[model samples]
Target: MGEEAAHRVHSRLDVLLAERGMTLVELSEKVGLSVVNLSVLKNDRAKAIRFSTLTAICDALGCAVGELLEVQGEP
Candidate 1:
């Protein structure tokens, strides 16, 4: 696999936000997180996330962890 393919984990925050008709600013407020931090995750640029942060985001979005993140691989 190529180097890019090696990174299979992807964030689905954008999709979830869109489905809920929410914006990053709104999520930041609800989750008590900075917009900059959330943007990192939403754009899939974050290398890691704290459990508390994840839980907060999940609660705000009304989504499971699995729904917020996904693994994609070549068939």
Candidate 2:
């Protein structure tokens, strides 16, 4: 068998927020984050997220992190 390869995955935060009828601003307010920071996440431009921020987002969105992220083959 061929060796398995590692790959990077991405999130669909923008789409999810749209489906939930939520804007970045609104989510930011609810999650106690700045709109600018939320926009970075929404636009897939954030390099990393803190645990506290993740918890706040999950709590405000009523969703598990798994629902926000996915795995796929590397680019």
Candidate 3:
């Protein structure tokens, strides 16, 4: 499953939230996003994320874009 797995982008949202002692509910509220949207991202099912949303999330999490999103595969 090397190639298949490589194409998958895993979300570290859960880890970040836990590390910061924050919950998805809290993040969603702070970022002005719905829990469903955040949950999809957290579950690694989001097909795409807007730049604004990413910025807001990063800001709310006090993390950089690199810390939030990562390329899983070697290109």
Which candidate tops lDDT? 1
Local distance difference test, each candidate: 0.92, 0.76, 0.88
Q: 1-75, model 1: which lDDT tens digit per residue? A: 775557777899999999999999999999999999999998878878999999999999999999999988754
Instruction: Output the lDDT of residue 11, model 3.
Output: 77
- Estimate, for each residue in 1-75, the C-alpha lDDT of model 2 and write its tens digit: 333343244667877787899988889879878898887777666667888887788787778888786766654
Q: What TM-score against the true fold does each predicted structure earn?
A: 0.87, 0.77, 0.84
lDDT of 3 at 74: 55
Give the Cα-based TM-score of candidate 2 against the true structure: 0.77
Ranking under TM-score, best-scoring first?
A: 1, 3, 2
| Segments of candidate 1 deviating more than 4 angstroms | 1-5
On residues 1-75, what C-alpha lDDT tens digit does candidate 3 reach at each position? 575565567778988999999999999999999999999998888888999999999999999988877777556
Indicate the residue-level lDDT of 33 in model 2.
83
* Model 3 poorest 10 in a row by lDDT: 1-10
